[model samples]
Target chain A: GAGVSQTPSNKVTEKGKYVELRCDPISGHTALYWYRQSLGQGPEFLIYFQGTGAADDSGLPNDRFFAVRPEGSVSTLKIQRTERGDSAVYLCASSLQGHNEQFFGPGTRLTVL
Target chain B: AQSVTQPDIHITVSEGASLELRCNYSYGATPYLFWYVQSPGQGLQLLLKYFSGDTLVQGIKGFEAEFKRSQSSFNLRKPSVHWSDAAEYFCAVGVSGLWNKLVFGAGTILRVKS
Candidate 1:
């Protein structure tokens, strides 16, 4: 892909439901990131991946929020027992290497109702 | 931990007027600063970034930013505002040792009046 791409542009799920958001980063990029943005606020860092390993998951809100970049290209963010507070736009970004400028995706808007 | 602060929650500027958005950050060492713009229903677009050397950096779309190490600030400026420039602006700071995980400010909403 020319840029980072996220799937299921929007998702609405009931409370306590599980959801998975997908992200496909640009080819050859070694770094990927996930962020969550609430209305009227800036995007908050959620997780970061370097190659096939998660370099940083400190930003994930809790254990329920898990992300995996198995092949170092495509990544998945899975949430368990969703809550209304979890409703937000999930963004994905990719960069050629660590500490480099990142290219962002259109983002997936997840609504927990 | 690195963090960014965009003091102005909302700003309104008339078309053709000069524009300046303030940003401050807290970082332990030489910080990598960035500015991004987001229009409604759109993804974030990097305006400019400051890594090393020049304190003043020029970005795309007629945007520029100046990094002040003393004040711990990196402010975005445009010579003239356009109605099309109305959007949300975010200031971010990245830790030098961290692996590109950026900490972003709350964001400033710009409303350009024609």
Candidate 2:
């Protein structure tokens, strides 16, 4: 059985550029979540998806951040006009429905220079 | 809003010494508490969780946590820490609802001295 996986383990981009981080959740997981971790800080929730629809997105910082899980197995977090402040490690997690435990991925570090 | 607090910014303990990491959370009603460890370049790993029944919960890697409602705390403890135990520990509270949304603390860095 495979665990959660994220692509582009590390990404560096200029300010005002766009970047997309991909997450492949474990097989049969019905819930997905995205979090951001800054230096010297813990991870903060960004968005969450239940199945193909986003159940809660209040944690998204702004409109520039968006995520989609079209097929219910993979998710992509898109950032538009990235800013230096947006630089951080983007983490992806998945869990079985009705389960409290969340399995996290290795994360994609996004650097906005 | 539910929140978590990890007062200790950093802790250093000998490999054979006892270890305890304090965690306090603020949430209404019965809260779902969790302890997670994050190693360098690795994803977050769950250490233990407390929901109901016994206040003392045992978890993987010889780790355990005690939930004290009076103190609103769930502190992680281990009898003897190993050098490989050095990492960042996070205390999180899960908001009980249709989806379990986690609210995490600032985290405490643990250093194991051999």
Candidate 3:
């Protein structure tokens, strides 16, 4: 893809339901990241992947939030037992390498009702 | 741990006026600093970055940021503001070492008045 792309531009889920957001990074990019942006706030880091494996998951918030990038290109963020507080924009970004400039996707606006 | 702080939550400026946005960060070593802008319903776009060398770094959209090591500040400045510059701005700090995550500030919203 020419830029980072995210699926389901908007998602609305009920409490206790599970939701999945997908992200497809730029071609040949080796670093991918997931971030969550709440209303009136900047995007918060959730996880980072250097390749097929997650290099940092410290920012996942809790056990309910998980992400995977099995092929280092496409990534998925899964939230289990979603709550109303989970409503926010889920953003995906990719960089040619770590600590470099990141190109962001359009983002998935997740609303948990 | 590294963290960024953008003190002003919101700023209103008239078009063609000069603008400055303050940013401060807490980090142990040399910091990789960045400024990003986000328009309504859009993702963030990098405005400028400061890796090393000169204290002043130039970025896109006629924006520039100066890194003050002693002050722990990386303030963004523009000589003239445009109506198109109305957006949310974020300051981020990355570790100097290889392959580290970026810690971002809460963000500052800019409103341009015609």
TM-score of every candidate:
0.96, 0.97, 0.96
Give the per-residue lDDT digits (tens) of candidate 1, residues B1-114. 788899999999999999999999999898888999998878899999888899999999999999999999999999999899999999998865454788899999999988
lDDT of 2 by residue, B1-114 (tens): 888999999999999999999999998788889999999989999999888899999999999999999999999999999999999999998876233588899999999999
lDDT per model vs. reference: 0.92, 0.93, 0.91
Q: Of the candidates shown, which would achieve the greatest DockQ relative to the real structure?
A: 1
- Candidate 1 TM-score, C-alpha based: 0.96
For model 2, how big is the CA root-mean-square deviation? 1.1
- A best-first ranking of the candidates according to their DockQ comes to 1, 3, 2
Report per-prediction Cα RMSD to one decimal: 1.2, 1.1, 1.3
Using alpha carbons, what is the TM-score of model 3?
A: 0.96
Runs of candidate 2 exceeding 4 Å displacement: B97-99
Q: Write the per-residue lDDT of candidate 1 for residues A10-96, one digit (tens) a residue.
A: 999999999999999989999999999998889999988999999988899899999998888999999999999999999999999
Model 2 agreement with the true structure over A1-113: per-residue lDDT tens digits: 99999999999999999999999999999999999999888899988888999988999999999999999989999999999999999999999973648999999999999
Clashes of each: 0, 0, 0
Q: Is the docking of candidate 3 incorrect, acceptable, medium or high quality?
A: medium
Q: For candidate 3, lDDT tens digit of each residue in A1-113?
A: 47889999999989999999999999999999999999987788899999998989888989999999988899999999999999999999999987678998989999999
